[model samples]
Target: MDETTTAGPAPATTVGPAPVGPAPAGTAPVGPAPAGTAVAAESGGWLELLADDCSPGDIQRLRAALLAGADDATRRRVESEAQLAETIRARLADRGRDARELRVRDDLVRRLASLRDSAGLLQEVVAQSRFLLGVDVAYIMLPTADGGRLRIDIVDGSLGDTLQGVVLRDGEGLGGEVMRSGRPLWSESYLDDGRLRRVRSVDSIAVSEHLGGILGVPLRFGRSTLGVLLAADRRPRRFSDHEVELLAGLAAHAAVALRNAQLFEENQRAVADLRQSNEALKRTDELRRRAGELREQLTAEVLRGGGIPEVGRAVARAVGLPVQVLGADGARLDAGPGTDDIDVVAVTGSAPERWLSGQEPASRTAIGRDHLAVVPIRMRDGCAGCLVAVSDVRIGDETVRLLEIGAMTAALVVATERSVAEAELRTRGAFVTALLAGDGDDAELRRRAVAADIDIDAIGVVVVLDNAGQDERAVAAAATRIAAELHGWVAQHADRFVVLARQHDVASVRARIAALGDGDLPAAGGIAPAAGGVAAVRTAHEAARQTAAVLLALKLPGAVATAAEVGPYRSLFSHAGRDDIAAFVEAALGPVLAYDRARGRDLATTLEAFLGQSQHHARTCEQLCIHPNTLYQRLERIGELLGTGWREPGRTLQLQLALHLRGLAQTLAPDVGRRGNTP
Candidate 1:
């Protein structure tokens, strides 16, 4: 057991981790004594010729000259030295046994010393072999992430374009098999091997065997082979026993160098981990110190409510941010942290999407110069609004977390402020509405309207905006900006509802929708329209909504949309409750439902398709991909059961309305239920 442990080897550890950062590269072979002293080893015939003078300087110069050859010996640099140098001339003849071992031993020592001295010693070994071994080409392939494949790390210049970084998996190429078996392999002629034919990168079998003699040794640290080291001579260079020994020695040295690099990297990682832990601890202490002060500021802001722009400002300050409050949809509510010296950046449509879709941690960006955090402000579990935090530096985790907490507290503050502002606006909007309705004094209403940011006498249109999704911040922001723009228009007449929509009920306003012409507004897409608003508001909103829906329905590849373009459904404006439509459909579709229950067929999908097809036999058949006979039969059965034929426009409309209502019910009812369930 002891002998095996020392000589036979204990099982190998995993291929050490990849070296961190850059490593020295090239290859040379040497043997190591028990004390780890590297001694030069003899090379086959070449080493004897090179070591003729048997001087260390001579050997060094020879090694350098050989290593100097172009990766492919396409040039005669190494060959030139071999020809002119006495050592090179000596290689033209055979040398004595004592001289060969001495030469081999010296080469081994230098190779081992290089490995021990450099970070990328393995790479160096491959480079040295190309110089010293008179090989036409060479490469060092390493195992990939899975260790199931070999990847070429370095290749000769001639093969650079073709084989550099090429991957050869186990059982693949001549090199791959050697890598898999942890054995030295040689192909005196590569073209003859059936296995080499399998190498994918080698397009031609002739090309694979072009090397006169190809030699490979598995690179192993212990029992596991990292990959294979390959050397190829384009001309028939005899593979001497000493040459094999030298290559094996280099392979061993390369493995050890790789292991050392991996250990150095591991030590570095340990230090980095310790550093991060210490940094995290420091941040925790900072957070703790600021927590108390932040909590007080937040409490005070909450008490003031959202109407006060100062409250948003206060929250930003508490979290050390220069934030602008926004609605859930991403609207700039009231620019907090003052806009005087502000620099605007890119704006995405919705605040929620922006916040949630962060690819990187939010904290880092939140503190960047002119960085803004658009935080949604929630009240009583509902998102009442949003706020932005602008800072001079990139935000850290501590900053983001603190801001999140502060926003929650600020929500109540901002909401309270909004309530107060809305009360005043509502008083004015009410008078204006009454005047428009002919129930109030017009002059007084007009005067009040102007105060509420509305010009009752203006010929301009009113607009009421609401976000369709949870991201009200952007929508609310667009509303505010549009309102400001409408107010700025010189139509010489006032548009009612120029004030924020917060004061008015979204469903009660009614008017014809007039969409803005392309020239009338900036091309911001995805705005929702409010059809249920006061005259101009409803008109403008409906136009916007219709535009949005049409755009959405069109499905243009890259067309953008805005809330103002997406109009409310006609049903939303109707006095009739949607539940009535549902009741009607439930009553009419009983037979179809019954049939579905009996047969387990998806009757609902079929009915939906049938109705949408407008009773066109060809279209319906194509859509359903059924025979005309089958479609007709189903339609007939449906008509008999539902008391409506495909041609009955009125009944068809009713069924269509039913389907739409049911879908709406499924989606909208859940929120209603959840709200009702809440205390």
Candidate 2:
């Protein structure tokens, strides 16, 4: 029998001999070899095979079989199971590592992706953090403005029901201690830890049975600590190194997210502020444009054919008011924006003092109980009149401001119109006066006089005076006083206008006033005979204006002029070319002016009085309230400097003109030191 042939019972022919067996498909065949040689050669393969399943102990058994002449099919079958087992073990190890990595990566990715909704970013960060570490409770607490409190922004699970939106104060509890130090804390047991304190003061701090192994890491951005991230276990659980690292990463991400959100909010606020400012600027521009248009329209209307009364009526209608146009005194009723058909509307009486006196920013009277607005009709010169309106509702501030501005424009138009009308009246009156004086036809003269409101039979007269720089109160008072005095004189004579003073042309007023009543009226008090009629008025006005101008030019360390006076330079008034007048002023006043420059004295006072007194010692002394001796001494000095006798006729006239010019300069001057240096 061939040993190579497979048999039920094999016969041992040698100490180590080959045995026969059927081979499995796709396996190498095994054969007999020398005992030691075969064992040695096959032991390496068997050891490598045993590494798949049974390990080194199985290698011994395979080596023994090889020495006992094991067949090729048996060894090959053994090798297959060992190799198959080894491949399966390697695959299983790789799968486990991949699964662990996938879980960690998926968690990180999900947490990062959840930051889209800013409202819930903190909540998601806390809730998802449970998977990566040993944490029974996780919360994000943001620092509040007040140092004592920390605002719980988000918490995990049912923690919201127990601790949602909680505030913890510093040094009050475990969380408090963490915030106070601005550092991470770790404790095996929160209640048991000696460094941790239990909060008892507030009823809101929820007391759990035992929160162990608590950890609090500060959430910070640069030097600014935003809040803290807290994690705790119910049963004490130590955190691994990797878990701590994960928490730090979470804290970093949280800080960045919060900062980014804040920056975004600030950007939005800046945009809103810019838009608001732009809108305000646009509204202001529109208001300015509207004001310009309104001014243009009102000016055009006044320049057109409308008289003051007509313009007043139109303005009153536009602004919804009852309008009155008064003369400069506010007493002389000039016109009313009222229709005669409207019987219920009463016109302003000749005297307006009763209605408009003692009022500030003008006056207001309620129409029934609902509405009122009173605005002074202010002119560039002064307030000539006022516009008063009443409505059935309360007026707002903006509306009042607008009404005032509109009223001011209307007042300016009225003033301009008045000036034009007055000038026309004056020209017409002068023409009529010349005709009557020239032996014109009696009927024509009387007819023209009546039409022009002139009194040819009473003798023509004009009285002009300084208007006090358009000081409305002073002008009105002076005008009233002057009118009363003239009326007294006229009443004694007849119902003749002894002094008919209009508000225009002060230059000729004194002459006109002087021509009245066959020179029978008493003398004007303290006014020189040379300065009668329109000349007197012109002289007084020129004196005042000049005094104001002088004070302004000299910077004469003083307050405003309360009073000013001018007297005639008789000889200069009689004769002297225009060029001679300028030269005379330069020579006479030049020495005094030089003295003033050097000494800073108000020499203007003495110079003005000396010229007005015609260089007479008694007159100069009386006017200056000094003794004649003192007046003479001053004059002697002046004459010595001027190189002439103080009483010389030609010199007197030159000195007077110089004094008048100096006074004129003062009139144009600004009133300095009016407001004392109080501030």
User: How many residue pairs clash in each candidate at the backbone level?
Assistant: 98, 34
Worst 10 residues of 1 by lDDT: 14-23
* Candidate 2 lDDT over residue span 1-679, tens digit each: 5322432121221011122223333433345433443444555454344334332223333444553555778667655644553444334433544455357646655665545555577776676566545467888887777765887778884443566667778765667776778777777766666766666532333444245676777777898877888887777766655456567677777777767666666777899999998987886786566556655656676678555565556555554545444443354232654532221123222233334453343555444454555556666656666554445566544345545665676666666655664464455445433342343565665676566554544432333222223333443344335555444111100101113433343434433333431232222211211133333433433333333333334343121231223323222222243246556666777777777678886455776687776556677778889887877677666666667575677767767767765554333322222211000
Q: Model 1, 424: alpha-carbon shift in Å?
A: 14
Q: What is the C-alpha RMSD of each candidate to the true structure, in Å?
A: 20.9, 21.6
Runs in model 1 with CA error above 4 Å?
1-119, 156-160, 194-197, 203-209, 287-292, 300-308, 318-321, 328-337, 340-346, 349-372, 390-396, 414-679
What local lDDT does model 2 show for residue 644? 56
Relative to the true structure, candidate 1 has a C-alpha RMSD (angstroms) of 20.9
Candidate-wise lDDT, in order: 0.53, 0.51
> TM-scores across all candidates?
0.45, 0.37
The whole-model C-alpha lDDT of candidate 2 against the native structure comes to: 0.51
